[model samples]
Target: MYPTEESDPFCLSAASATRLLTDAPWRRFASMGDSLAAGTGDPSPGYANLGWPDRLAGTLRRVRPDLAYLNAAKIGATTAKTLANQVGPVLEFGPDLIHISCGANDIWRPDPDLAEIGWNLRRIFERAAETGAQLTTFTLGSAFVVPGFPDWHDRVRALNDITRELAATHAAVLVDMWSHPVNSRPNLLSADRVHFSTSGQAVMASELVKGLVDVLRAHPVTSDRAPE
Candidate 1:
């Protein structure tokens, strides 16, 4: 059994039921947000960047052989642009499962606006929820790990707090990246010291899949709509 709210108020429980993915009613998966979702650091020689979302999709494919996946994320995307550009395409895809990761870029900018970031994120979450998809997002790990961004640590924390609040308000799955063991490991980061390395991506995908499975088990879908 998963930990109760009393035991895990942060909702950082690790999922043990791998079979839940097979049983969940997720046929179409869509991803939005920024470069992290775009799979920037984990590059392949021939194929496109296989980021954590792509890795998660591959795992989902194992359970549902016919799953359709679409990633509309781009490198260097801000929360505002993501809210504007990615929402329409995601809604068009009509995915039953969606992942969104953004705002890190905005937080690093000079004179970062926490209120504006929160507003844009709320809009994105609200719009995504309208599609009736099970949405998932994460709190950024400590920005102290990122070289040359020591001053932005507080901003990252603020954004993470907004993300956590929005996740609860919107009933979306939240991955507590701040508490994850990989958060402190420097090797998990790519040369840029911002994005995750291939191994780091794998670790993130592993943890994220667990969260997704937990959400599915708690709120099993009962629809029969096919992927469009």
Candidate 2:
């Protein structure tokens, strides 16, 4: 069902990764995971545009237009589901940078395991390493707290722990979205209270991009010597 693409389901970064092999500065960057990164149901004027990745990509292009950015995020995707499907696309694209924001669905499940989340992450990290992409990830905020989710705060915490440990192991730059205090407020949520409205997505996108900028700046890419 999911074939590789010119406009197919899985947009591989292989050509971009290869272009990097030729010393192109823009031959880098890929994002994969769930809705937060996808900016699912982003509200812009009427819940239309302005997802985090779009905003993040805008900022990135402004700062470094050379970057080859690809976002493969799906709404309602768990970390496991992301790996199951999205990983194939990353393998194809093989860009030099990767961003991950996932695991929100697990919050709704009765019990979730951080280590299993870690396992899913390892699969992603290993794949990135294979392609020489520097991976980055974000801990999803507490979506459950919106209305029906009396347990959201706690579930998000548990998941963030797993995500952090996974990042450490994979050497990913961590974006801790859960730690944001605004999540405690109801305005950050849509009428469903689970998803962010367009304005909310903009805020979250700004938050995530800040972390990404910090990391990219702190550890500026220096190896001009393209890998063989």
Candidate 3:
């Protein structure tokens, strides 16, 4: 069954999500990078068209009605591209919270330069962190498969490793979806089979909310390191 908030126990209800983020301190939120950041996906039958970032912003706004948000993600953007283009605008936005999604396009072709991709991703993390913003990112889900790429799984695994390493190094909140149970659902992918469907996006948003709630618990607002 599609994970609609109305019926699916797995999906967070509107009030539940709001309650989870009631103490969130972020006012300006910016999302940058590739298609995943853009929330590129097919719409599920019962879900909203909003992508994960938009869905997250909505919840944040519920907590703080004056939330400001910018989603500067482009489809097919590589890590290098995101660093070159998106970073400046995000910095200009002065976001208190930032979400990054990149490197998926970089590994789409054979013989991806994992080293270079990792370098660009590290820079992206560094720049976002420099803004004093709490950073959030997601590992590519295992279900995001591309046919005719013999080493596709290996490539994704390697990229995810880099993402995890950088997220740890930068203290970014990471949603490690590489082997999430949601990926096992039959309706997880869109028609392209590369991006997630709205069902998956909903799951991403739900997980992110949960992750942030945990972060808040560990580092309450009184702490200097608390997410603001």
Candidate 4:
């Protein structure tokens, strides 16, 4: 009854969602990093089977029927692993738009090295940015908690800070989901209570579309010119 309702958060129809990104110029979209980027989660009652990336691609395809899409995200992938693994394939894909997600797995350990994580992430962003693609990413929601880790909040905050700094430095379109009102919803996460449910995935995709729409408003991308 919640997500199925049009009044619920992120319950946008395909046409309504695509309308917001009518000016989007990206022909090829690729996503890389961790399970969050992979869109792993339990099936939510009122949501589609699609993950955020697929859902996003669907909307993009509506505007550009020839849009090419790739998702190279893996479960349990840390920042270092993402750098070592996914980046090459993503580069090879030669995407015009790239969505990156990581850092959560890096901080899953009891003693995470924030400095190292930042360095790896910076490298990841540098490589992605150098490709001249429109980069997009989102911060983890506050509801994703690791129970045994007493300092979970502190860790997430620190990681979010790093993500924010990188996003600013690279001028990446960012969806700042940290402390978002959606996190308050009881059904936001899956049974694992870690990854987002389909409802959350839908919300993530819609939010990302909105983020791109905002960027297009501030700096419209011309047909001849790539996204700035």
Candidate 5:
């Protein structure tokens, strides 16, 4: 059941419980998903997209200067396509850490199949796990605030639940955006009211960095080389 406006089921308290990996220097970080992972909303010169992944990569570089980054996220890609196309390159990259943030596009479809979307996501997570990479992901916040999508809150809620469940089952670090108070802020969203603004991306990167820090602290990297 979806929580009411007065209720805060999706709170930051859960994020506090994310067990930290031992402090490790992540060598390679790969991102796979849709525009969110691709960093579409924020444009940069000489770069097609500069979103959260780039931001997170930049932050991670502070500790691991040799960190190799790969982003195979394409605009408009759904979970099924991401599972089919994006996952291969990620596996090929053999990253020590991975981040995925797809399925929002699927939710916007005229008639989305939540069940199939969840299945594809599970496959993607399972396959990524096989590579032995530390994974990170986030859930979507309420979409009711977005204009013309009055009833989308429930759909987004269902999707978020699926994401949370998969993240737990897969032992993936989760940045619970759905519960964050920032989700209710209008300034975080772009003019389109769907994609995040530059500031919003920064905020997301900040949250991801926090999660990554905990993961690194708990699972210290014993090797300086990428996982093979």
Candidate 6:
């Protein structure tokens, strides 16, 4: 019963019912977001083979290696694009857990309607929550260094704040990557000053792992994190 302004039921439409309600331990989790998530431009095999979600899965797999997961990230994506790519697959997967990192590209575009980004993310989370799936979101690294887009740094900060605030509202775990070695560590990025090199992506994967660990701790349904 998600509260909504719509006059009638705030619940999903009947057409969406099958996709909305899920029974889980969502071992078949799905990952969503942008290039950083896709590890785009990562000039190393490590990121290509093992991005953050994969790293998170591996650490958890240390106990339950067979756990099923999927990454639906795309290069150069924003929240709007993320919704496009993520909504259908997410509904189809009905994943027990979901991790999202987007909105940086949106900031790059300098859209006047910042609310649209927030609304879109909330929609994604609200829809997924219908199935009682656990959710996690990432505050991506800085946008200033994204090469061609210089005006985006402040916008990215705005987007990150919105995402973190929403996470608190919806009880979702959050990964904050806009600062620290990800932002400060020169070795973590490519010469383009925007995309990550392999090692840099690995660092991202580590942060992502921490967020997933937090989510798993909260949900505690999977066997990997059983009383140990």
Q: TM-scores of all models?
A: 0.82, 0.73, 0.94, 0.94, 0.80, 0.73
Which lDDT tens digits does candidate 6 get at residues 1-228? 212212222112222321222212446667788876565544553234445566555544444445677788888877788887777887687677777777767777644468898898887777767777677777767623655656567677788798898788777777677774445544455666677565555556555545555555555553334464
lDDT of 4 by residue, 1-228 (tens): 465524556567788889988888989999999998998877777678889999999999988888999999999999999999999999999998999999999899989999999999999999999999989999988987788999999999999999999999988989999977889888878888898888888888888898888888998876653355
Give the runs in model 3 whose Cα sits over 4 Å from its true position.
1-3, 222-228
TM-score pick, better of 1 and 4? 4
lDDT of each: 0.74, 0.64, 0.89, 0.89, 0.73, 0.62
In model 5, which range of ten residues has the least summed lDDT? 12-21
8-119, model 3: which lDDT tens digit per residue?
Answer: 6557877899998888888999999999999988998788887899999999998888899999999999998999999999999999999998999999867789889989
True-vs-predicted CA distance for residue 98, candidate 1, Å: 1.1
Q: Global CA lDDT of candidate 1, please?
A: 0.74
Model 5 residue 93 lDDT?
93
**Colliding residue pairs in candidate 6:** 26-96, 52-205
TM-score for candidate 6: 0.73
The per-prediction CA RMSD against the true structure, in angstroms, equals 7.1, 9.9, 3.1, 3.0, 7.8, 13.3
Clashes of 4: 0
Candidate 4 C-alpha error for residue 11, in Å: 3.3
List the candidate 1 regions with Cα displacement exceeding 4 Å.
1-20, 43-49, 143-150, 220-228
Cα deviation of 62, candidate 3, in Å: 0.9
